[model samples]
Target: MIVISSGSNHANAQTSMNTWAGATAQRVAYSTSRLQNRPDSAVTRDVRSALWRTPNLDASGIRVRARLGTVTLTGWVPERRQISLAGHAARSVRGVRSVSNQLLSRNSR
Candidate 1:
């Protein structure tokens, strides 16, 4: 018996592996593999590119680094909202296992 859990009691119900739901689950697993195996260099470039693309956030002073798929954002922003925006931008990039937002608001200066 094969069971796929989707956060409900019925998730324990057995289903044929040939079902459409099974196919969807397989696709999700494949995508997860891609996320786990991304190179740190690629992840860093993607995060930096995303930061540059995000509007309303002046990422000029921001520095992005990636290690083992975990991205760290550091430096300063003009406002508190920009800090959150910068973190969001980093998190949105593919292959980012996690984000450590260390950006400081100008108020702290």
Candidate 2:
């Protein structure tokens, strides 16, 4: 009969497990960054459309920046109401966690 002992083989198994864990951590980090950056692209398009149709907003000058799940709306609109409206519209989009209203009045332009 042949028996396997736990010294060398156990060491090798532990090392392999550590290596796999390190690789998994690296992959998770990469995936997280990709997910963070993805919102920037997706929200830009939605912001454009929502701003265009919002009666209170001046869509032409509006810009949106997204990081992680946060959105910031910038540039000028004709009315104060537009600023609130812009933030509301951004918040309504899927994956938006928060919004910063940086919209300025048209007179400020």
Candidate 3:
């Protein structure tokens, strides 16, 4: 005859449950991080498009980086207004949480 103890069965079940819970938590975390980056990518694209549409702002020299919906603009512009213009254009994007304008003026030196 085969005999199975209840306590042993309970402990085995608990271990399986814990393992499954850990795996599920990891998957959720990975999915959340992946989804979060999508918006930031879209924000970068939208900011670049906005700059291209604006006049007198040369977007070719501008660099746009986005993380967690915040955008950092780095590059050179000919005038001070162009800096403000770049910031404004970045802010206009829907997914942009904030803007860090670091544009340098060519004549500031």
Give the best candidate by lDDT: 3
What lDDT score belongs to each candidate, Candidate 1 first? 0.84, 0.77, 0.85
Give Cα distance to truth, residue 38, candidate 1, Å: 1.0
Query: Which 10 consecutive residues of model 2 have the lowest summed lDDT?
Result: 1-10
- Candidate 3 clashes between residue pairs 3 or more apart in a chain or in different chains: none
Over 1-109, each residue of candidate 2 has an lDDT whose tens digit, in order, gives 2233668887777778888999999999998976654456787777667778777566777888877778888888877777788888888877678888888977644
> Which pairs in model 1 have colliding backbones?
none
Q: Runs in model 3 with CA error above 4 Å?
A: 1-38
Model 3 TM-score relative to the real fold: 0.62
Residues 1-109, model 3: lDDT tens digits: 2244678887777778888899999999998876554477788888999999988887777999999888999988878789999999999987787899999878644
Q: lDDT of model 2 at residue 54?
A: 71
Candidate 3, run of 10 with poorest lDDT: 1-10
Model 1: per-residue lDDT, tens digit, 6-25?
75555544444347677999
* C-alpha lDDT of residue 34 in model 2: 66
TM-score of each: 0.66, 0.58, 0.62
Who is ahead in lDDT, 2 or 3? 3
